[model samples]
Target: MEMQKEPVGDLQLHQVLRMNEGDGDNSYSNNSLLQKKVILKAKPILQETIVQLYSKSFPECITMADMGCSSGPNTFLPIWEVLEAIDESSRKLNRKPPILQVFLNDLPGNDFNSIFRSLPSFHKKLEEEMGGEFGPCFIAAMPGNFYRRLFPPRSLHFVHSSYTLQWFSEVLEIPLNKGNIYLAKTSPPGVHKAYLNQYEKDFTAFLRSRSEEMIPGGCMVLTIYGRDENSDSSAKHSPTIWDFFGMMLNDMELEVTTPENHKLSM
Candidate 1:
């Protein structure tokens, strides 16, 4: 897929960028096993946050939000983890479990219908495990970019996002960044500056939006891919996969290059 320079508000482009539906070859449901691993890796952090919240004050109702929840099996993992932590804490404290209100968020173009299809089984399992202990639970979908607010002010108690915020909401295009895409070694200084500026802009917006929505004792667990600051080579860091992709593109261009074509293309 070609990377677009457009921002997240480009709804038409978002529709194209969204994951494939069903369990097909390119479907997120089939391809998100790695995402599941990321969620698992962050489980301990999530548990600790929940424990802290329970220790501080056990609210009568818990409001949780999972951002960038791509439609798939991994979509429900955060909710399950939260429920487990809440259950354990409640048992240890000998207190009644709180009513739960969970919100699942993603871009408007996400496969929400596909996600909804799996809810029947999700609710069934939750009921079986949490019957008579916890109050009635409600789950709903909130569709939009996480760089902006989705919930009401002081409504959310916890927010979770796994391996998602590493992506900038949009890439700033520079004429100097001609052949290569996304911060290549050969890119000019301006390109690097532009990327950093965009990163700050988007991330700042994300944090500010969450701040408005979360309660006083709220907590958020975010998992993102960050490069080692001491590493000079961009290819050796977290974007190694993208580096390989750029190499493949360069190779394909070389294969099509010839004396006559080279002069014409230039």
Candidate 2:
């Protein structure tokens, strides 16, 4: 049987430019400039939360995975920070650091070259911090569609995905009509419904897959694009950088297609 072709959209294209720097030297710098502030502010909060949660359950869990770990040195920054926090916490409790199996996942087309280029530096950082006594840290790439299987059953102890789950394999388009007033606009009812439906399906699959591969008490830390605390369900657009990317995608001439629509379970 032939494998299904994964869907692509404006977000993927933008990522290509950001990762490949096809536009020129300044393209990535410009993009990073725009994202720097938000990245700095959010990294600590996300890192703290994931570390705290995982430490509470698996105080010595060394095996962890970062799904959708696109190519970038910055991508691993927060992950390492979280690991360091876990190490410190473990030492305080008089326990040896757990052996870490760091699995970095992404699409087959992702720029693994760049990721590999940064691996040595990451290892050196680990060596500098842990010296010879640091727990063994092994890094490997798991290339495939995350919507599908990515690891052996019941293998992972903790999982982390950031700003990635909001992106469905495809963007669902909502046609403008008399019944749908929010079509083509941000937070349009139709668009919101479409996005949520896709997210629900994908997220459920993600949870199920992880559940199978994760220990009963395994922890999952996901920082996704979401509506504001005060926003109602009627508001469709994410109140995060994803919203900006979505608008940019629309402007870049990418067509959004709505597949099967369904309600999502939180």
Candidate 3:
């Protein structure tokens, strides 16, 4: 895996930052249990929404996209859940299940090749699991920043995003959040303000871009990375797995900068 560089100039995070790729132990595919849980938790909402959409319009084909679909087994989780829901609905309503046109979207730096390579197996599994009664699925990749428009205007019928919205397109170069990596209790007021400003700006852009791309009556579901609404901001911002990761990074930095280590390097 390539080391992530701290943003130095005008370069955006989307241009440089990439998720751990390939199916190695350290790769995102092997270590995204948290994200997997999030996706499954939102299953009910996705099912209900799909059922409603199908009831309203008996379209021959349904076009949907899953933003931030990193490579691995989880890559097809949304597709499976969606097709299953539609199949159930179709059986109940005595209607034909619409064929799916899936767009899996992420940053250009994402592991799109790995996803493409597994397409054969994925299609085979879908066919085996669902059998001939199910409609076919056509999947394609859309590698780009979701904060910008990714699809043609008024083309997509549904959008699903899990654990993606909180990541800003560009890293802020503000000289703040020094002691901590993220907005923690130690983060000063200025640091907090800067992060909040960036969050608002990025989220607004995301909404605007998606709104323009989705067709009329289209719906979306997102699992945003955020603190609990009931939590007190004055207190610690509530701990996440990334907080422990920040601790490990800080320890590594201290080790690298110790007098013995620094002098030996010199």
- Candidate with maximal lDDT: 3
lDDT tens digits, residue span 150-187, model 1: 88899999999998887767545654665675676767
Candidate 1 stretches greater than 4 Å from native = 1-11, 234-239, 254-266
- Residue 3 of model 1 has an lDDT of 42
What Cα-based lDDT does every candidate model obtain? 0.82, 0.63, 0.85
**Model 3 clash pairs?**
none
Q: Write the per-residue lDDT of candidate 2 for residues 203-247, one digit (tens) a residue.
A: 888888888887666767777756553555346644455455555
**In candidate 3, which residue ranges exceed 4 Å CA deviation?**
1-12, 233-241, 255-266
TM-score of each: 0.87, 0.69, 0.89
Residue-level lDDT for 47 in candidate 2: 62
Model 2 residue pairs with clashes = 154-213, 172-257, 173-257, 173-258
Q: Distance (Å) between predicted and true CA of 35, model 2?
A: 6.0
Quote model 3's TM-score.
0.89
Measured on C-alpha atoms, candidate 3 has an lDDT of: 0.85
What 10-residue stretch in candidate 3 is worst by lDDT? 1-10
Which ten residues in a row are the worst by lDDT in model 1? 1-10
Error of 1 at 243 (Å): 2.5
